[model samples]
Target: MVNLLPIIKQTLLITFFVMSMMLIIEYLNVFTKGLWSKGIEKSKWKQVLLGAFLGVTPGCLGAYTAVSLFIHDIIGNGALVATMIATSGDEAFMMFTLFPEKAILLNVVIFTIAIAAGWLTDRFFKKKFYIPASDKHFHVHEIPECTGFPKNTFWHQLKHITPTRALMLMSILFFVTFITLDEHLASGSFHGILKWGHSSHSDSDPLWIKITFFTVISLSTAVIFIVNDHFLEKHLWGHIIKRHFSKIFLWTFFTLLLIALLMKHFDLHSVIQHNMFWVLVAAVLIGIIPESGPHLIFVMLFASGNLPLSILLASSIVQDGHGSLPLLAESRRSFIIVKLLNMAVGFSIGLAGLALGI
Candidate 1:
């Protein structure tokens, strides 16, 4: 139990950041009336650019939104390809937590590649890969009430809060309080509070990360306070929490625990060093799994200096997380095409990077 304490703390930190990010994105999407999704149907270039932009965002929400647009025929196949190509699924959240600078650079590269690949895909396969007529029309549930704020005062809403709103508000407040306490204890800013069963630890995140978490959590607290039941229930709790929370938490916890155990038990770094080429291949192959949880191993490996940038990039390029699962269901042909293109791009980049010893 004592040995697991650090891993548990790290897992919670990562999960909090990931959840906060998703909440902010959901709020923006609803508040903007899905504005970022509009005008995307006007041009192929626009579709590709918008797709890449959304894909680079740190969660599967963007991919889901893009898939919704694609199935509706609002965006073309190329746009879907770009979105999947650029998206790293939920692993992106972990990447941001573990190696933010490299994660940023990786996303930029994925964005660029996604744009070019999307453009070329449309140019060549425009006729080859059309949205099947059956899947061409589907409905995305939209809460009309979520499009704008209610006219009621914040205090009034709080006074009349529903179960969902109350739960979200209390949860956000608890997280905020916990984060503040952790920061203070880690920094020894309030040493007198140590007797409260909390340790003054040295595992504090970097200053920028601390600031980022504080700022985002504060914004989230405000969001919880302001959003009406419709938005809180339908978007935040219903979508973000229900769909994402458990998966992110479990993946992070188990991945951290497995890594910890492996390091403790064996010479894992040496094994990886001896089979770097095979490891890169495995990374690209694992990227095909479609789920975000599998690729996290590569992200963690890269963060710990046991894996190369090439392998991480390759895995990222090939995997769309669970983002493509809907596409698989809606249109198997389109899903296959996207995966084929992704594998090609991922493998080429992996080999090139290896040959150049990057």
Candidate 2:
């Protein structure tokens, strides 16, 4: 139990952070669906650029948003490909938490690649997708209304609080407390697993991360006003939160625990040293999982200095940042085709890294 403490802390840190990130992103998606839909009615290149930019944003929100746009026919498959190729998935959150400098630099590279890939795919493979018509009355894109007796007043908003608003507030509180407490526990390291690389007790994330979290919190709090009860009940909280948070959290916990146990019992460093190529292979293969939890192991390994940035880049490229879930849900053919494009790009970049010693 004593030894497991670090790993437990690590897992909890990841779980809560992931949830918080999703909340913020989901809030933005719900709140800005109107603006997004309206704004994206422009050029395809603009859509691709927008998609790549969002994809490089840490956490699953950007990718998920892109997926939503694609599914709604607001964006083409090229933009979808761009988002997937650029997105590093949920692992980007942890990377930014531990190594902001490297994460940002890497994401820049990813954004460039995503833009190019998206453009090429759009230019060459342009084809109309037959999104099977849905008869369901669950309208996700309808503009929300502040349907109540009073309008935009604090009292009215407070009185008409939905379960989702309450939950977001609680999560905001939890994150604030968690960051402060975890920082104290780890002596500024904040997270035990974050201590893996650069091995410095004094190390912590950059100021931008703290700033971003606070910004997201404020934005999340404000979302209660912009998004109405129906969207919260029927879509944002009802669908995304219920569907994604638990699954991502549990999978992250177990995967970290398994890695913790493996670290306790065996020599992971030695095994990797002996089988570096095979390990890279496994990393790329695991990127195909479509879920974000398993990839944390690779992030941890990279942070521990056991893996290269290039391999991480490969995994990030190959991984669709959970944007594919909707695509997978809607049409497996589109999902597979997009993933195939991502894999090709990921491997090319990854091998180039190995070859060039990047």
Candidate 3:
């Protein structure tokens, strides 16, 4: 327990800092909203540029939410691809926390490449393939109520950013950490428990072992969340977390943590080292997953190793996930087709880059 204190403290501190930065950005809204609104009205090139900029940061859900907010109005269609491609997901912070030097540079490179490719694709292929039906046109007669700048004062903002919200956020972090720790702890605990049971009962089929193991894992996770919630409310941390439950921050953090755990457990580094070509192939074939977090996780894994730069660059071009699917679902068949073409072209470009050693 004593050993866990430092890790807990570090996690809490990182979470607080990230939240504070997001709050500051929200308060400013000038950069985010202004750039978005201004860029959307311009050519596809400008929209792609804006998308790339949005993607450089790790807020995949926030980006989508922003897109959804603007979908009815000011934004263009191709911008979605650009934004989705460029985002690194919130998990970059976890990389920074664990492996700062490599993760930072790798993320920067990935973001830059994704943005540039997305912008270019949007510029050349605007509305060429995927066109919405007449009833499903992309226009904004009136800006949605949620589409405007935030209207909170400095004091109001400060008042809302309390320790309770911080605590809630911390509780969420703790839950994630607990799962990782529990995985480690259970390996030993289970071995001992099974050994003890073996002496008492022979010929016990291990048929139920897999089922019970998973059940215990699921139950343990639920218990952690419940306990964290209860404890937070009973303490000052609860108020802080509650006060600052910004969806963007929460989602971003969750995404980042997921990526970190994936990398930690999956031996992604070794996979990248051996099958670098196939990894990039997967990127080109699948393009971006709908969610930025999942997409970027693959990107980061590829980037962290000696994968060919061309493959890396090419993989970044295909924007998948959040940007394409929702639009396809909205009867924008032309847009969907255009997105697929863009992805194909992006993949080709990556392949060409690899072939040319450019």
Report the number of the highest-TM-score candidate.
1
Across 90-149, the per-residue lDDT of candidate 1 in tens digits comes to: 888777766677789899999999999999889987663545567444444332224467
If both were scored by TM-score, which would come out higher, candidate 2 or candidate 3? 2
Worst 10 contiguous positions by lDDT, candidate 2? 137-146
Model 3, residue 190: what's the lDDT?
A: 26
Q: What are the C-alpha RMSDs, in order, of all predicted structures?
A: 4.8, 4.2, 13.6
Q: What is the TM-score of each candidate against the true structure?
A: 0.87, 0.78, 0.50
Candidate 3 global lDDT: 0.46
Superior candidate under lDDT, 1 versus 2: 1
Scored by Cα lDDT, where does model 2 land? 0.70
Model 2: per-residue Cα lDDT over 237-263, one tens digit each: 776568766776676667666665666
Q: Relative to the unseen true structure, what is the C-alpha lDDT of residue 267 in candidate 1, on a scale of 0 to 100? A: 73
Ranking of all predicted structures according to lDDT, beginning with the best and ending with the worst: 1, 2, 3
Per-residue lDDT over 1-358 for candidate 3, one digit per residue giving the tens place of the 0 to 100 score:
1233333433443454444333333323322444345435646666666666665554333354435533544455556655655544444433343344555565576556656666665566555333333445443212212232234433453455446545544655664465347653223322122121124233432445434444433543332233222332432233223444343344444534554555546765566657755766777666545443444445344433435555655555554434444445554653455457556656776667666765
Q: lDDT for every model?
A: 0.77, 0.70, 0.46
Over all chains combined, what TM-score does candidate 2 have? 0.78
